[model samples]
Target chain A: MAKRSTVIAITVAAAVVIVGAVGAGVAVLGSRDTGGAAGAKGDTTVTVRVWDEQVASAYEQSFQAFEDKNPDIDVKLTVVPWADYWTKLRTDVAGKSAADIFWVNNSYFADYADNGDLLDIDKTLGSDAKSAWAPSVVKQFTRNGSLWGVPQLSDAGIAVYYNKALLKDAGIDPASLENLTWSPDASADTFVPVLQKLTKDAAGHTADDADFDPASVTQYGYNAGNDLQAIYINYIGSNGGTYQDGDRFTFANPKTVEAFQYLVDLMNTYHVAPSAADTNQNGDFSRDQFIQGKMALFQSGLYNLKNVADGADFDWGVASIPAGPEGRVSVTNGIVAAGNAATEHPEATKKVLEWMGSAEGNEFVGASGAAVPAVTDAQPVYRSYWENQGVDTSKFFDVLKNGTIPAPQGANFGAAFGAYGPILEDVFAGRVPVAEGLQKAQDAANAALDG
Target chain B: MKWTRTLLVYLVLLTGAALTLAPFVLSVMTAFKTPEQFARRSSLSWPDPVTLENFGVLLTGRTEFGRAIVITVLAALLLVAGQLLFSIMAAYAFARMRFPGRDALFWVYLSTLMIPAIVLVIPLYLMMAQLGLRNTFWGLVLPFAFASPYATFLLREYFRGIPQDLVDAARLDGANALDVLVEVVVPLSRPIIATVTLITVVSQWNSFLWPRVITTGNDWRPITVATASLQSQYNGNWTLVMAATTLAVVPLLALFLVFQKQIVRSIAITGFK
Candidate 1:
């Protein structure tokens, strides 16, 4: 009976609480039927969606200028995390509840465009926009003779971010770091000697010393983790390995296999890098380790420039990715904004999309040092922004001008990677031999690509 | 020997408690430290000078967490109350009232618990969108504001355990079914009701996926969604995230404290874990 009565009291309290809250919510949120379409025109609220908060702040500034000039359309920017962005986007696009204009990279834009869920930018902006944008970015979005997305920003691909102080302690010149090169043959070379000089064992012996113990090394010479964008893509590309031949995956290239072996050997044999067992779990672990001054040559892209700048206690500077056997290679990638096909206001959305494609808009993203804007004229702002931050970003553009390979291009690349990403991790961790692991990975990827 | 056994039990219990509480304690401590301090010191080290900069950022309208908290509270209260009220009424009918095919209907409803919540996400999203409720406050709360089959099943089992003679006395006194339910059944079923209320509250409060999918902007975003946004927006800065989480969880902790006696009574009566 006591139990029942206490339960009764709790239930009554629950009722009172709910009723009180509902009443308060009605008063605060406005008692109304919000059943009509969302983002409908009172004065035209054009919802613009992005994944980066820092980048979204830039968009907000850009949109402010846009609104000030237009005075008709009110733009609201929504920033979803990178993890949830695709999942929410698929549903939103499917349900016709997506933002009027939203960010979509080349890898993802295909599915949306193929499904007719995105508005073709060519129809909105015409050919005038294409010539002004970076050719690779413009080409990335163009499918079936139609441009699906307006190029917003591009990544200045894989470059070595060496801690200058760490290099100085190792008695290596910061200017001379660019000469390091890797070979698939695993024989002692310039890169190996460099790593040996930089890598020190717990007993204060360099890797060059025969007594140096791989087990007790306190700091790593390099950060060779399983980052698809920064580490392997640059390795495979610089080694002249091709993963995709148009629409299908073909990682069976010997150069690709050799490149995988070298990466795995960096951790397992030479012990120049951190093992995959630790770093592979979190994509950001290697980056975090590098930023904490625990690692020497961190070969990542311009995306991590801000993280390194804000976090590092020591002086650091960028150098071109190490020259591989086939000269240096970098993988440049771009982000684009796609307008929703089912958006209610087509004219307003086109105007918004056009603004996003314009230099006036993308320059805000560049000037903020958030991204290397894809609008050809806006690239200078990005470079100057980084230059002000005490890092020369000219190499980022040099790589673009020199041989920057675009990331694997295809409609089925996501599916292919989904099938083989984990298997490649085993290869990196040295649980599976690189040769055998990649053979299996190639089979799995080809099967997925076929589907 | 007895003292040693007591010591062993305490040691084990304390170790288990420490394991559970360590993460939470670390989060709170981290929340009070600056970025420079956090980066320099070990995670276990105490903050030399505690600062609420993270809390200041989260609560000072930079994240719209205050709005999210109010929305979450409203959603939870409404969901819990609705679930309890409807569950009680349904359980009464299932337990005492002789309705045709009641068992079959109740079994069918109970069987729905087998399906995963994810299977319902896309369909539920489409259904809500068709009703034009997506991004609205109603959409955030509507999916949860009903009797759960699990709650109803639990209540029905508890309701059946009540003595028929007591119900008969009220019925013989010219009390209608509604009067007997309101006056007799509910009063004696407080423990089960309290248990159900707690379950409903916790489940609704922690609901992340559905609310995340439904709401676009912060207008109808709940605490869980808001907390997740902090992780990505702030680049996994644990201090700021911990502050947001600490703010989000305090209300639930307060709710738990307020109903301490009722929860204890319910546990004793129902033997619920």
Candidate 2:
């Protein structure tokens, strides 16, 4: 009986696998009737992929407008979360199942462009289409003497979002906050003094007071931490130093080292900013503090604009990031949409891609205050939408015009960033000296780039 | 002296239980909170105005939380049924059948358990894509609905432990293999079968990575995939996340409640808990 039962179980298990496989095969046959790659199969449906849910609604509206205009062509937009976007896209591209049109960031596009996974924009749109958009954005997507994507939106500057009530209680002028300047030498710098003035102990003494206790700071004066984009990147570039020289990290530069040291000193020496422990443990520590009214000024990208706008109960305003010895040079980055080279319906995909690059399509996103559209003409609507929300978002644009630097970008940038990010954490945490950390980081970045 | 030892054991068990159940308790509490209430209050606090707005949003949102629940339940059912059927057959063959590679094949099959799923995803995904199974219902359930080594190993051992005298007695009565299996061995292996069924159901219900990778469209996306997508980088929508998490967990909790006796019986009989 036992032997017989074992045989029956084995037979049953094998039968189930066989049946499952056969079922899958039957489904495959049915799927083949839908044509290849998209909507209704043989009928013309173009798949478009994007990563941001905050802007997905706007894209859906934009795609609807496109579909209305081009009734023959159906567009399907899928929003992959930011975390899974690149991984899914990479696998899809490898499998030749990528969307007809999808987003391509500067750091990631080079591999696709190099491997001929992306459709050439120059071939699709021509010289006239290229010249109409922002010059820098056009330059960004241009790879191997051919443009690979159309820039949808650009994010370049970091503005200080200050709690109005915090500044008010600190007796600090909002106007003075805009031009606050930092230098390697504390006595020569104006930024540290402003931070010192804003910071207060539980015993009612400001950081400027000799009797002030660092242990019981009720409100932090500033958020200076390991955030490369909003904090250290601005400091590095604004101090006449650059984080990256082309593809290789150049933070070991004398001025770059000075910038890092002075910034680290704000936390360790002056005791104005939060410790590396707090910042290192939580990515959103500063933003949370600012919204909770524990922070005076939070310098960050417009990516957090919606979160701050919706979350804050206190009155808030935006000001340009503090200047260094040279000037306020915030790093700007852009998001672009690329057409898949391996798409089955090239002509249909091209038409969809063209619409994505058009101001008419981008206008939906801009008008809804989804993001700052790359099409210069559509930007006003985006600004006005935020203004209508009773928040002046013009500070980002204002700071963009003030000697801005491009965010670090190159073929091996993604790899290099993964290597150096943790190495610098030690420097920020005071475990490693800035000079030694920068040196080790430079080597690591170059090694990753070599690969 | 005996009471002291009992008290110590109770203390240890209570602590372990609290530690294990704390996250779920927090999730349930947060699910009832408004976004502002969640952010402002302590994690341990009761919701001042208990609301179901988060649940309402998830259920009605474009992701279609209701559809995900239905899909997950269907997949879990299919998976458990198929897995048990296949695992039992394979285990029975290995234990009692006289195939040439019986021992060799069993060892080989067992070795695959040591291989990581990550190493297999690419090739398996390619195979599924070639089979045109991606985004289909079967794609979500079929890859996982077969005889796993662990399942086969467990059942094979239980089958071997069945008495040879019982088999001889059944055969003496002119019982065929199928009749003997259905009437005798299957009845004797109830505890092990129940245990396998529970494990299969739980694993299938909570399966995330496979569903996320396989299903591009939400037509076949399970609740785990849907729950994960709710989390954005910037918006700390903890209340909404907790609601989705609580919703994902409720089915498993209900399943446990329904099968509590069988599960306990299986554990006691197997003596493997």
Candidate 3:
């Protein structure tokens, strides 16, 4: 009898304590919010967001210069790692709480601009301001007759990185690698023979030897896999096949089929490249293998220049990407700094954006050797920085003279990749025939984009 | 036959233990290697000349991982204290009292566990932004300081299984409700309480998504977010990342060491083992 009353009393007291603590927590949180806003009282604070920590550090020095000239405005940089950058940006923009300026890639620009989330660059910075940046990035960002972002950085072009000692051991001259060209016709091909000479079996036999055992391969000659940017897309373009045409997949073209067949045969037939079973799941497998001195040739871009320079303990040199039947055509991708359309501090934000696009401001990125600036005039600093390290930067830049294809540019490109990624993985692993796989992948990619 | 069966069981258990411990062993091994050594050698290989450089870079360099550890500790401590206190009181009420709509209210609160956390991210982010709490310590910890549905449910079920005679005897011995709770209920519920505390601390420590969305700068960022920043877009720096990971995991491991006995007893009593 006494227990029931005791239980009631305890329940009442507990309820009061629970409610009181929650109320206090909310009160403290609310008060702190007010304090934070009030603390930024003197100068209008404009925030900038980026994904790369290296670029963020470089921009810290650049923005310090910006803040020195404009004493009344303060700039703060926020870095989100690449894994969460898109997710957080989408949520923040939808909530109307994104930074005044944030970096956007080509694949995501169309979505943000279509949703009216980005400030129209042509309208904000005038159409004449486009001349200050690289024409390729400007063209990539321009849609429906208005520019969407200020160009921040560009991937110059793809190039070949060779392990000099490995090439020498294989009796292959590094200089010959520059002029190596491939063709679908085996009689006309000069590239595979070079790779075959570099590859070896466990019994110290090169792949070209009659006694060479494919199962016991100890060294690979090249990195050929399902890598879209580094391996297959460049091959597709160089072979006169198209991967995309006006926001749709065109990978089922006959030339694209021939290119895939050549790549698959390099892995499954000739065994000059690592098996696709290894490289399909791990995108960094080829780069790591090259750095480990197990592979002779690695085709990648400026993104990997510092990776190889810092990671490799052996001597290495950069050379032009092997040309195909048509020519050496590489994919050129770039990143842009887009402004918030509804930013509260429009004047301050525009000032920050304008400074980011200028040659003096962009030079900080190039001078640090973190990336090549999109501003053409600032590119010399990047070249000179690499030259000081004894690396020839022209290998990356020289390919730009022949021709280039833009990186995937539709808003649905990510969705399209998701739909076709597994099929491509199967195709690369040689479980699916090349022609049939490309057709299935093309249909799936187009369905995803058109849906 | 008995000896052979026991030997077989021991072999299986040893194999399982090795498989479980392999990745953690590799992470620690990798953390002690230089970047070049990490890329050159097999992942399972031991560091030849073990270096402190990765730790030095993580703790003293621009990553400022030491500061992140301090912030994570403070947030986890606050969250554990608040969550345990409120959850205990709430669970006790739901178990003992026969109030109006008590079961209905309890059921309604527990139903929230069915809703996914991803659905709440946008709304919660908007609320915090409107309050000007973005990038602030309060923004990172405040939303999670209250009683969670899962914790409350676990505690309530355990409280219900406690003998009612214990409470009645305390009442007859001239003890008030508060005395009965502090001296009787809590003293006997040590194992479950320890379990709750450990669970709260570990979840709050390893929390990534909410903290990633809430804080932006290093000033208020926690260890999980800072550890993620060790890898840039282009560079993996696996050795450096593994170092940061090893540092972030030490406190949780220490906590487990301290409370292993009570946690095991809780698992046994709850029939979860």
Candidate 4:
């Protein structure tokens, strides 16, 4: 009986202790005002979260200037890493504890906007602010005629960046090269022949010469083995293939098939490009090969320009991508500044968005040389910055003006993109025909869309 | 012949050690390299001009690295304490005590071990939300802190191996069950406890997925989350990332170095030899 009483007493004590610990934890958490910013009136401090640390330093300086002009309001900057940014933002939104403002990517903008996770800034900004950005960028941030986010920086896919000295050493004139006239279909017929002429084996036999050993060529003509969006999108777009038709993905069209076949022919039949096995051995993202002067051509974006410019000992130049049947086409992509719908400081958040959408903010992004400013007005400023740094930024503008195409956008596009990499590997490896690989991609894309 | 055999064994052991430590050694070397050196050189080679800029960046209060360290350490501590206390008590009961249907109850508890952790996530998350524990340290620690069936079972087996005479003598000297557990059984079970503690510390310290899913912000984000973030941000800046990774893993290495003797003894006592 005494032991039973003792057991009962111990149980009660444990229960009390557990309850006390829980109560104390709750009290401590509750005492802090998580909603303090919500109740602030008039001029308030707005926090903007971004993922690009390199660009954030420039943005903070620009925001300081904005604060100088508009002393009534203050801005706070929160920088999250690119990888954790989306996951963190999603969780914060779900918990109703998100930052006042944040950055969004084109890949995620549609999902975020469609799900009503973003604030509708169209009513706040009006037509003047809408007209400041490119039409394609405007289209990306708009869902059901409501603007969800403001475009900050934009990029376009272009041809392999080449070392000027290498080209000159091979007696190739950069000025005489028709950058805009060549097409992916023309790659097998004309471009590969030219590349063959330029490529020389260590034994002093040009790739085009009789008895030239294709297997023993030390350097390749081009780097066609890269991310599909980086190389294939240009081909697909130029051949009149659409990434999405209304709500469904349609990359299985004949145009897309032709483009895929053209890319494969560059490796297998023409032998102008490196073998898939060779590229795999080097590593998937081998842009550094060109910068290090190992390869003559490297496929990438203007974002790489800064890295190459800083790292390369040799002179390099960006050129317009080769034209295709439809016209010169390059995939357009950008980052957007958005607000979390669940943020407590809605008015302050809107003010922050207004500042990010302003000319000053655009100038800051441009001058930093981190990315091309999304605003049309600030393009020249970014161009001047790159030119001052001894890079030819003219090709970027040429791509924007005459070579740009809308990047792929669709429901569950992220999921579809995840399936594309493996399918591309199969195509490159010769295990599957282009048609079979594309059909698989389309089916996977459509399935993801349904989900 | 014996010398030859020893030489072969040494060669194999050295090869295994090199294979195991290669990635870690590479990370340490890369962490000290400048971005230019990293981009130009092979990932295996030492830096031409080594620098601590990466460590400086990580240790700065402006970045999430410092906060991540504090969160990881605190979570590990809470997890270790909770797991040990509950597991010891429950294990003691299963090994020493008699009750109606005790074997049946113990079996039912052990059966939970078969259920995968992923399958329990959604239901457990819902429970946490319902209890208003989401985004809290308690939320990160509590669900996982309880006596795991595997852990409890292991401890129970170890406890059962303890000589019952010591417990019986304490009980005869007018000591209660709790007293016997604290005074006699616990002292005899030190080696097993150390083994369990080491296992718990390592597992809890390296836990990524659950803490990642539970925590909402940098306020509770752990070292793994920080490491992942660093990897993504500096995808091109491998030098900085390798430095951060090396720093993040050093504590575990240090813990192993300090407690290796105790750990080996515990392993022997637990019949894991």
Candidate 5:
């Protein structure tokens, strides 16, 4: 009797397993057949992939407008979060299953263009491609005399975002911020003194005070750290130094070393900025501090405009970045929407791409205040939208009249960035001298590129 | 002296438990906070006015988190069912059935556990694309629906430990191999089976990388991918992120509550804890 019961139990378990597997298999396979047959029914789907969800939402409206104009073409927008966007795009492109249209930054597109994964914009759109978009944006996307993508969004210029209350309390005129200048030597440098005045200890003593405490700063005076776009790159450019010369690191230049020394001094010697130990690991540290009302002057670009506007409780205003000996030269970067070379529905894809390049279609982005549209005519819409919000955005566009220090260029920028990131962190932490760190970083960057 | 040792053990365990559960506690607290409160107050502070706005936005607004939850649950259920079924058959065969190269084959398959899932993503992605399965429900679940080496090895080890006498006695009663397996081996292996089911379901529920890579748009995206998309580079949206995490974790927590006894029993029986 016990044997029979044991046999029954084993058989029951085996039966459950068999039934579960078979049921699941049948269900999934049945659904897959329907799923497989669900494609290519009515309209030709031209998918557009982008990383920014905010921009994706804006493009949804823009694409809706495009769909209405072109009735037969259906546009689908895929928002891959920024972290995995590049990895997924690379994999999808390798498998020849990438989107009909995809957004590419300057750093990552050169490789795709070189690999022939992107369509030639010159052949597809002709002379209007050059004439219609922002000159800086068009130049960044151009490689070997061929344009690879349609300009979608441009980060106009790096600017300083200041908490107005902090400056007022420090007895520093906000207008003086617009023209503040810094040099390698402290004799003629006006920027450091303002930072010292703005920075305060817990006891309400400023950084210049003899009684001020360095270890317990209540408010940071500036954001000077390892950030390439908003901090060092702008500093390097305004000091008559270059970050990369045709895809090679050139920070070993005397001017670049001077900029690095000044920035390091702000954090270490002057005690006006956050410690490298904190800012080195957290990219959002300065921005978060500014939003939390702990920072006086936050140097960033148009990217953080919405963050500041929404997060800050106090009045804040924008000013141009402090000038170095050479003047304020901002590093401007732009994103372009590239057409896939292997897309099956090329004609429909071209139509959608053309519509994105048009002011009529791109204006939705500006209207929503998502980003500054790369199309020159649509830019006014972005400006007006911000003006309505009681913010003057001209500081971003005004500095662009001074030529930009070109954004990082190179297919292997990711690998090169990985190579130099740790070494630069060591330099910022005061473990390595600026001159020696710059030389090692330059060598590492070149080696990564060569590989 | 014994009480001292017991106190020390409890102290260490309490610390470990607190460390493990601190993040979940924070997630739940932040999920109830308004964005303003979350931004202004200390992270450890209780919400002054506990609100469901973040949850409302996630479920009802453009987030599509509701649909993602449904898709994730369906995929997890299907994958769990298939995995258990196939794993059992393979495990039983290796443990009970006399076949040439059975042990050798089991070890060879088990060796794949050392290989990372990322290394196989490209090849697996290519295979799915070729099968016209990309962005489909099948693409999301197919790669993981079959027998996992970890599952098979686990069950096979447990099956081998079952009393051979019972199987022989069942066979003497004119029962077939399937009958013996179902009536004898399976009844005794319920704890291990429950453990496997819980593990497989939890892993499937929390899966991110494969779902992120395989699915595009909102059609077949899972909860993990959906929750990730709520926060962009410039905006952390901690409240919204915590709300989404809270939503994703509730079902798993409920599952654990329901199966708490079985899980504990499995650990005690297997000497794993």
Candidate 6:
């Protein structure tokens, strides 16, 4: 009787296993058939891969406009989102099954272009297309004297975005912010006093007051700690320091040391900026405090102007970066649109690039107020758009014209960027001194470049 | 003294539970928020408007959240079935059936577990490509289906624990080896089978790198791949990301809830008490 009962139980378990197996098989078959039917008609479809979904719908609308002009080409815009973009793109490229055209960034462009993963656009581009965009945009994408991508949007380095209300309360004239300058030797003499004058405690005592407590200050004078790439590169350029001297890392030089000292003074000696601990706790968006009516000035990209305009209720204005000993300088960063070498429809891909690089298309993207147009001629459209939106974008163009310096270009730009970022964070935290941090970063960057 | 011990146990359990669930709870709260809210506040708070806009947006695409759920369910079912069937059969052969060098073969199978998954990825990928299975559902499913040496070894031990008298009785009644397996060994191996099923389903469902590498389109991608892709798309907006994450976790959570009885029983049977 017990044996019979055991046999029955075994039969039931077997039946369950069989049923589950059949169900799984059917499900797999059903899904594949559905996918096949959906993807069957491949003739009329042209997929454009992008990295941001918030921007994907916007691109869809833009592509609809493109389709209206060129009715023959049916476009399908796919958003891969930024986080998965590189991983997905690399896999697709390796499999020879990538999208026809997709967005590219400066950091990853060299690797893709060198590996023949990006389609060379030099032969296809017209003279007007070649000359319309910024020279730096063209230079960055150009590999072995052949351009692999068309410039879509350009971003310049850190600009001092200050709260006008905070400046007013501190008795500092917003009009007096022009032609701002700072050198390592001269910064404490000029900027520190300005910082001290601006910083105020909750009890309303200025940092200059004898009874002032640095730890208890409610409002800071300057905002500096965030991404070291943005802050350090700006410092290095302003002090006439170069990251590399023809493939050799040169950040251990005196000019770079001067840049490092200036940053250290802002946090430790001056007591006008947020402490290293506070910045460590807060991370990159430490600038948000400035927009929220806490700090006086925040240094970040002009691209953040839109975010501030949308999020902040307070009045804010832009100013040039404080000049170092050599001269005033800003870092250049931008997005590029490139055709996948694995694309079946290279002709259609070229057409998309041509249209995107055109004056009308660049102006359309610029007018959206999401990013600055890479085209020099179309920048006025962005400036006016922002001006109408109640922020002066004149300085955005002025920085591009006078102060824009391209970010350090190297073979392993991505690897170097990743490795040195955390070390710089440690430096900013005062756990590691600036000299040691920079030396460690230089060593890492060199190793990455060698790879 | 009793109250103190109870309190200590409760505290330990609650802390463990909180550590596990906090990220998930935060993800759920963030999913309903707008991009602006997500960016400005990285805390676990409910969105002001409590919008279903991200879900609405996710639903419109070809590889929507709903589709990803279906794919993941299908993959999990396949993985569980394949693991159970193969592991039990192999375990039965090693545990009861008299064959030459059976012990040596079982040891060889167990040894393969030491070979890391990373070492096989390239060769497996190449094999799949050659087999014309790349980017297909079979491409993602087949390589992982019947390939768990640990699961087989686990079941072998459990099958070995079953009394030999029942197997001999079934064989004495003119039952074949297959019939003996079906009639005697399987019924007693329920606890281990349940444990293996749970482990197989969870691992396959949460797999990221393999599925991401094998599956080209959203059509073949499982929940983990889809969730990862969604997270990347809304990287700046933690709210929408958290929502997608919440959606991805629901099925696994539901499975755990449904199988909780069997799971607990199985764990207890495995001497984990």
RMSD to truth, every model = 3.6, 3.8, 4.2, 4.8, 3.5, 4.4
Q: Give the DockQ (2 decimals) of all models.
A: 0.35, 0.29, 0.33, 0.34, 0.37, 0.30
Q: What is residue A212's positional error in candidate 6, in angstroms? A: 5.4
lDDT of 4 by residue, A1-451 (tens): 4654575577557656654664565444433223234234465667677887667877878888877777666676766677667776766667665677888877777777887788877866675687888666887667687877888887745655777876787787766455434455454344566566556666857677887777876656677764555677777887777666765777688888888788788777666677777664344335666655656666667777777777777877766666677776788777788887877777767777877887767788888788788877877888888778877766655665664656766556677777666777778767789899888878877887777
For residue A110, model 6's alpha carbon misses the true position, in angstroms, by 2.2
DockQ-derived CAPRI band for the predicted complex in model 5: acceptable
Residue A16's lDDT in candidate 1: 84
> Which candidate, 5 or 6, would have the higher DockQ against the true structure?
5
Q: Clashes in model 4: which pairs?
A: none
Off by over 4 Å in 4: A1-49, A60-98, A156-159, A178-181, A184-189, A197-218, A274-284, B1-3, B130-134, B270-272
Candidate 4 interface RMSD after superposing interface residues: 6.1
Interface RMSD, candidate 1? 4.4
- Comparing 1 with 4 on DockQ, the higher-scoring candidate is 1
* Residue-by-residue lDDT tens digits, candidate 3, A56-84: 88998999899889877778787888877
- Report clash pairs, candidate 3: none
What tens digits encode model 6's per-residue C-alpha lDDT throughout A324-425?
A: 766667788777888888777777777777877877766766776777778778778877887788777666556655565556664567777777767777
- Kindly provide the TM-score of model 6 when superposed on the true structure, using C-alpha atoms: 0.85
What overall lDDT goes with each candidate model?
0.80, 0.82, 0.86, 0.73, 0.87, 0.73
Native-referenced TM-scores of chain A, all candidate models: 0.91, 0.90, 0.91, 0.84, 0.92, 0.86
The digit string of per-residue lDDT tens for model 1 on A1-451 reads 4544565587678678768768788557643223133223466777888888778778878998888887777777777777688878887887677988899886677878889998888878886778888887887788899988889988866788888888999999988877777887556347877887788778988877899899888778888868878888788887888766776666678899988888888888888888888777676666666777778888888887877787788888888877788778888888888888899888888888888878888899888787889998888888888778778987766766557655866666678888988998898998887888888888998898788
Number of the top-ranking candidate, with lDDT as the measure:
5
C-alpha lDDT of candidate 4 relative to the true structure: 0.73
Task: Summarize candidate 5's per-residue lDDT along A1-451 as a digit string, tens digits.
Answer: 5666665577567658655664565465445323244244566888899988788778888887787787777787778888778878887898788999999999989989999999999999886666989999999999988999999899999999999999998888899887799999889899998999999999999999999999999899999998998999999988999888988889799899999999999999999999999899888788888888889999999898988887788999999999888888999999999999999999999999899999988888888787999999889999999999999999998898876799998888888998999999999999999999999999998899898
